[model samples]
Target: MSLFEGLSAFPITPADPSGRVDTVALARVLNRLADARVDSIGLLGSTGAYAFLTREERRRAVEAAMATVGGRIPVIVGVGALRTDDAQALARDARAAGANGLLLAPVSYTPLRDEEVYAHFAAVAESGELPLAIYNNPGTTRFTFSRELIGRLSEVANIAAVKMPLPADGDFAGELDAIRSVTSPSFRIGYSGDWDCAASLLAGGDAWYSVAAGLLPVETLALARAAQSGDVAQTQRLNAAFEPLWSLFREFGSFRVVYVIAELLGLCKVEPLRPVLPLPDTARDRVAAALIVLRKHFA
Candidate 1:
């Protein structure tokens, strides 16, 4: 299987109240994910709060994750920055730090054109030899990818996989089919925005870039395994069980909900980075209740 072709854990960067990336907390989270037997760990993905931290903090987080992983599994570090040069620099650093792969998003305050976006990944691909995954998260970056553009990008030599967010239109089964028709077979497909993972995977997509995997890897991996095994009946049953958590993701965003679940589970002291508050107590109570059902019946 491709390195990211299974459940790759995306953890929130655990920082202290002072906003410093707490290496100890990060190590604990990494080891937990490793023990869960994730195929890989993606550090500094948006879930990891890469945008909120300084470049130095990101480097430190990646370093900590690499040390903690100890080559037991592949580590893909995000090299996304608003500026192309900065992104290239981060990619170089990732290569130097011995990361096995790179993940980047078209993070921009201003809108980016097709050529500019292509250039961003191409420049970084030239900077280092590690494999790269293009992350297309329109909700967070306000940048979207047309299938045509993604096809063109897959031509870049080192670009390996694409991490896609399921569309708001809620037809990801169709979306995966559409994406596959445009991109080549060599360019693997992975979905993020975890709610629709079962549908995407059953539609023959390659992998899931999972938020829940870091916090609830065993539960999430069970669903992924069902999808991979072509057990449609089991996959649907598992998907039905997760609809409650999916509802919470739609209502209050996965970033908040997952951290609350992690905190309640005693996984880590997870709080969103600055400018975002913790989920309200009522929301947490709802998530706690859903998790109870999940653990008792589904998980």
Candidate 2:
């Protein structure tokens, strides 16, 4: 089966009130998701506050997750860094630590041209034995890989899949169709930043990498299954129910609110990392209200 075939929960790295990674709390979150039957777990991705973590912290977080998951399901570690060598090294470390695959988010600095990005992936592929998935989140990287670039990278021996963050606006349907048409037939496309879960599936995403699913796995899995089964009504019902929580991302800039709400929901205990400040009192109140509404539907 393809690595991207089913629901994968992107668990936020739980941190203590002082902002140190709370390994015990993180293990609990992973155990709960495993119990919910999520197909896989992705560690240290954007939802996990990867950018804020020191290299050692990232390694420790993966170790904690692996201990909890313990071969029950595959783990895909996000390997993104300012330097190509660092990214490759992280990929190797993740593989050595028992990760089944690596998710490479494009390097942010220097804003590489398409060919350069491909070369970077090529280098990482050559360095690691594990399969690799390209994580394309233009909003974060400021450099979105073109379909042509993805097509080229898909040809790389170890490049297994592409994770495209569905654009918040513009012609997403057209964008998806364009991507589907251009990418290699073997390349799986998993939606990353999208929250319109049902609509994204209807539009033909093979799978979803969701932070919300970490908190409400059963509901998220049900929504994905319903959509996949072609039950439009049930899918819409679930999607509509999630609209309030989804709006949190729209109104407030970052996904920090969702992370905080996850904590409020008892899914994870991670606090927001540096520079990505905690939600303001007003935003916290808003998130609290949204969580109340979300629990009514998802719970």
**What tens-digit string does per-residue lDDT give for candidate 1 at 1-299?**
78768888898888876679988888888888889888888888888888888878888888888888868879999889999889888998888878999999999989999899999889988896789999999988888988999888888889888998876787767877787788777778888877788777877878889988878878888999999888999988887777788899889888888788878878777689868899988988999988887888652
| Candidate 1: regions farther than 4 A off | 168-174
| True-vs-predicted CA distance for residue 126, candidate 1, Å | 1.4
Model 1 C-alpha lDDT versus the unseen true structure:
0.85
Over all chains combined, what TM-score does candidate 2 have?
Answer: 0.92
Clashing pairs in 2: 15-270
lDDT of 2 by residue, 1-299 (tens): 67776677887887765456888888888888889988888888888877777777888888888888968978899988888898888888887788888888886777778878888999898777788888998888998888888888888888988887776584557877777787777778878654665667766777788877776788788888887787889888888877777787777743687667766777665657666778878888888887777678865
Q: Which stretches in model 2 have alpha-carbon errors above 4 Å?
A: 16-19, 167-177, 267-270
lDDT of every predicted structure (CA atoms): 0.85, 0.79
RMSD of every candidate to native, in Å, equals 1.7, 2.1
Q: Residue 4 of candidate 1: its Cα lDDT?
A: 63
